[model samples]
Target: MARRGKKAKGRPISGWVILDKPKGMGSTDCVSKLKWLYFAQKCGHAGTLDPLATGLLPIAFGDATKTVPYVMDGRKTYRFTVRWGVQTTTDDTEGEAVGTSDLRPNADEIRDLLPNYTGEIEQVPPSFSAIKIGGERAYDLARSGEAPEIESRIVTVHSLGLVEMPDADSAVFEAECGKGTYVRAIARDLGRDLGCFGHITELRRTTVGAFTEEDMVPLDELIDVADENREELDEEAIESGAKARILDFGPLDEYIIAPEAALSELYEVMLNDDQAGRVLAGNSVLLRGRDAPAFCDEAFATGHGRLIALGAIDQGSFHPKRVFGGKG
Candidate 1:
């Protein structure tokens, strides 16, 4: 008999890659670079970070993409520097200066006033943003010299604190907030609140979901590592040395916490093998023998399962809300 083709090997590696995005590059550019590096079949980002900002950016590959929305819904933290006395069209250092002010509030005054912004409050997004109006991107309209009316959105600011007051005209602060919150708007509003126009001079996202700046690997460092690995293969002197050497490249699991780890904060329900199978087969579970919320009514209207994954349980049934496939 002829030899078989060695069973076609194993499946492609899949997981998340958290990049420490460099300033001046858009989020899409980061994804494109990673796709080439890994030769992945599919990839996507959980959220978009501004080109002017730098920090933790979660890029999901394979089945991990299914868990992205849960991760993106988590809270975010940022540290930004605001410069008083000038306002800008885009609200950041990159924008053209549009207005000026002479008043400058003292550090103590700003610290005391910071409390008013904490907790739940409504905020308006900057004009030059990604928000859509009448199905057109706001920034596209803005670049055409047309000012479209933007609406205010209600967002929660979990906490706000002054980090430093470098001078009478500039201050640094930290903000913890929910999704969709804009630091530029906060800076702009802070200036107006204090009787002076203001705009952000610097902004950096320190944290997104569970990932933080500490977990980030600089782009230059990554590029250097890649170059070093390539050199090592050349020295090996094998016919396919480069390809063989790169094959030893490990999975990017350092950036991905366990799938369940991402949902540890949520109420958990374990399912038996039968329940797990049913969930995987697309069926809503009644979740009997446990205190799980009544899920029968919430099951899919078509009777097909909508759960994504199932978890371990000592006893009783818990429906799967999400599923993870090794090759997803």
Candidate 2:
């Protein structure tokens, strides 16, 4: 991978990269690969995916890292296949087999059980996870032979549909879930309820917020793809490159999507250049602009306005908190 030179020989590249992460690679490893591939100074992933899990992992390069949190909050959809009658130490196939059961639930029985997991449910994260416990990673503690008590958290499963039931011993499911929903936990709990222990045999993230697997580039393909159109790789090139790579894979204008594109879903109040400056300076600006039906006053009243992000009124005019670029 070619490294970006310290001196700005070309423009700096910055934007999101939708990576179709391959299994057996950690999220951090994927980010590092992209960082090297693009010659980016700063790069981070919106969310972590276990090495056993593969699918869409959004990589934020340059300024896009600042908006990673916003993207992380978005809902995720996954397609996972679970094998019944066996339980692994880590809940997924990556771990040692800890237990087994002979009995397996039928497809009809599984469909009946799926509804119970739909909507809101309580889940405990896997022990072999990045969760911090007493200032140490939970996985580290677990690996150190410590029994760390993990608290169960409430997570939402918006929808769960059975995609395929090949046999009584295995099933494939498509699930739309809110942030923090652990699919491994669901598999474990489901197996427990069915009188058979189970673990995730395979998992792939289908969607994360607005990004989807269809929008993702395979990690190998990304490595193979050449960054040849190396004009000025500034914000414009970065944005254009991301759109081209993820959305269209065609030539795009430097400004295909503005910095504000990251925050278009949030309620916004257009500010004058001066107000924009103040907002950028970290001051809370009142909503005085024309009322947008999309803008909720109650939400704004309760610091939802603070949740709002800023953008320039026009070209050359500056807005405070250009959330996409400045921080990275």
Candidate topping lDDT: 1
* lDDT (10s digit) by residue, model 1, range 219-323: 666555555545244555666544533343343334444444344345555556665567666554555654555433222111122224644322233444445
- TM-scores, in order shown? 0.79, 0.75
Q: Of the candidates shown, which would achieve the greatest TM-score relative to the real structure?
A: 1
Each prediction's whole-model lDDT (CA): 0.71, 0.70
Query: Global CA lDDT of candidate 1, please?
Result: 0.71
Q: Record all residue pairs in model 1 with backbone atoms less than 3 Å apart, i.e. clashing.
A: 62-328, 63-328, 282-305, 283-305, 308-321, 308-322, 308-323, 309-322, 309-323
What is the C-alpha lDDT profile of model 2 across 122-234, one tens digit per residue? 88888987888889898998888887788998999999888888888899988999988888988888888988899999999988876766567777665445344433446
lDDT of 2: 0.70
Off by over 4 Å in 1: 1-12, 231-245, 251-256, 268-278, 283-316
